[model samples]
Target: MQRPWVVATLFCLNAAAAGASPANLLPVAQKLPITPDNFCLGAQNVLKTAKQVLTDELAVLCTGNTATTLFKNLIAAPYAGTGTPALTQVFAPRADNNARTSEIMVAFAMRIPKTAVNTLLVEEKHAIVPYDSEAQPPPLGNQLANMKMSFQFMEPPKNEGDADTTFALQQTVDTRSVAVNFKDVSNHELRQYILHPDNFDFFMAGRTLVAPTEQFKKSVVVRGFMTDPADATKTLVVTVAHFLMNSRDQHEQLVLAFSNFLTTDVSKLYQEQIKP
Candidate 1:
């Protein structure tokens, strides 16, 4: 049965059945140490192709049972879209924010053909304006993408002890699987930001905020590369996992925005030249 609905009005996964794969396996224990410079750095790291990202300072999230469970989900059906592909996401079963931390993973089971990805260089200056840009005219993301992009403000969890919370620039469109706040770690460098796909390659200007929004935060790295496979098609795979604090109040609305941003705004951003 194909039913596209949100779980707890938080996650909207129109995904395929789950299965494990031998070819896509990685040695999780070999992950190295990586202390990113900023939140964007951390989020960007998570967005790398599975193999490159599986091992690193963030091994704790990718090792042991977590690694096994992740690969199984990754092996599911590939998302079949158009000249450009859309990500088919799978949610992890481990939903726990028991500690001051939470793990948030956005896994996409995809088979991107080398030809499918059309990388274009986009400007980054107007990528992220101040959070107060609401009063100003929205800037055009890219002439190619033709997107008048804007930013969203973030509200930290209210009940998680008083930490002098204020409005910080961040992205909504929540996959509120978990909530986390490194109240101890202060990376002030982590501010409002995003790198539109047009600024990179074959990708949608997924209008969703990439900065730390209502829940989780990290590097916002997303890409597709040619790989090795028997099929002459694209040979790249992607895996993303993250941790976010719990905020049901901000949950439903954020999720709805994320869905609308991707399906309505993002899906139409790029105009692909049909190859007949």
Candidate 2:
């Protein structure tokens, strides 16, 4: 059983509509051997619904890409199905504080060719490449000085037919910006550039994420085998879910259920590579 307050707080955080009870908010665990027919389109529906919930609870912003804009500007559009997308947010902890906060959420399905995920990940790593921005500042507002990126892997579904996979990502950019230094540029030049552009530079690698153990260390993984009754073609169903939060308290839970499912020890590999 879930804690009553947990349910209530989540509802309040999500800005659930009237009559949305606890039962309505929890994610139903999906079972494996699910056919294309069992691959309910409703999961997308639930993700779509989060738009208003997140917008109301947090201040959001976007830059660099259109797909990202669409994902973060989720208020106006329906849940989109596409490549890995990210969301950003700027936050001020106190009225008088000069520092800012940055949060990121990333969502994408684990499909596409083997090279696709690798290629995309490399491209994404450069999106926020480090550069000296001490001379400039963010165009939106004052810099909070301190910034960190929050990453999450939302639930991703697998195809029960042929072998196909994809990944979805949502990123939250905290309002804060990290200070960057250039070895080639003079301090004077760096200062001038930052003051003019209001841009800072920083470097980041795609590090695995480490979720709190007490809470659900959610996995975007699926495990189960089933033969399609219609064709007798062997089918394997794998479902995985990912969530983002600065603190464990903010994390959400995803449940998975399947028939004749065989559990595997993927956590050891997951812990080593997935958590940052």
Candidate 3:
């Protein structure tokens, strides 16, 4: 996959340094770390702890007795508009601190079966408008063959008076399904759907007390794959890496904690799917 955003990041830095003022630079904000004592509620709690935050690489293994049924339910959830269980909002935002709140939403363009995915080249096509409005849209077959997934992040409002805010494009995922023959990990062959984020654009709301920058460099990637471990059972492995660019120490710790919480939630969801 071609990563144009990496080049764009370098160009943006150079342009900002040449013409931007001191006030335009990103500020150094306090980093919130998730410790044993401070770890509370769910993923939402982790995000609420700090205005400026990121996540770490997290992984989960979902086990089920029925492989086919489990895999079908997992992949069909988002496409069915039922939403991803892992990304659900766990806690309400603080009403007193409107400027520091953060929200996440995921949307899919279309739904297609795993067997139907062949020679598909899914890519992110950016535009000023939200949806494509071509005079003659692509055929249903072609559209189903390729897919693009969007992850949106809404920054807190600048003030308590503001209404609903627009969500910024946090990540664009190019998706494809491939068959993998496992040898070392497992003896069974598996079908894997890989999601790669080709671009990440996260902006900080100017209303926040400690605004880092209008836009911050972020790196995030997620993968979900399934394989049959036994005669009738299946195993699903979901791994995600989300973090701020050039961030370390406390900032890294906070994001890692948030990611861990999300991973746990995802695992629980998978377990529930297979229950009688």
lDDT tens digits, residue span 114-227, model 3: 211110111111111121112113331222122233333334223221211211233332323222111111010111112211111111111111223322233333333322
How many pairs of residues in model 3 come into backbone collision?
1
lDDT of 1 by residue, 147-244 (tens): 22344434422222111111233332212123311111111111111112111111211122234543444433232222223453343333342334
Residue 230's lDDT in candidate 3: 24
Which run of 10 residues does model 2 get worst, by summed lDDT?
187-196
Better of 1 and 2 by TM-score: 1
Best by lDDT: 1
Which residue pairs in model 3 clash with each other?
54-255
Give candidate 3 misplaced runs (Cα > 4 Å).
Answer: 1-87, 90-101, 105-111, 114-120, 124-212, 215-276
Could you give candidate 2's per-residue lDDT for residues 13-51 as a string of tens digits?
233223233235544344233232222222222224321
- Give TM-scores for every candidate, taking all chains together and pairing residue i with residue i: 0.34, 0.19, 0.23
Clashes of each: 23, 68, 1
Off by over 4 Å in 1: 1-69, 72-76, 82-104, 115-228, 239-248, 259-276
Compared with the true structure, model 2 gives a TM-score of 0.19
Worst 10 residues of 3 by lDDT: 181-190
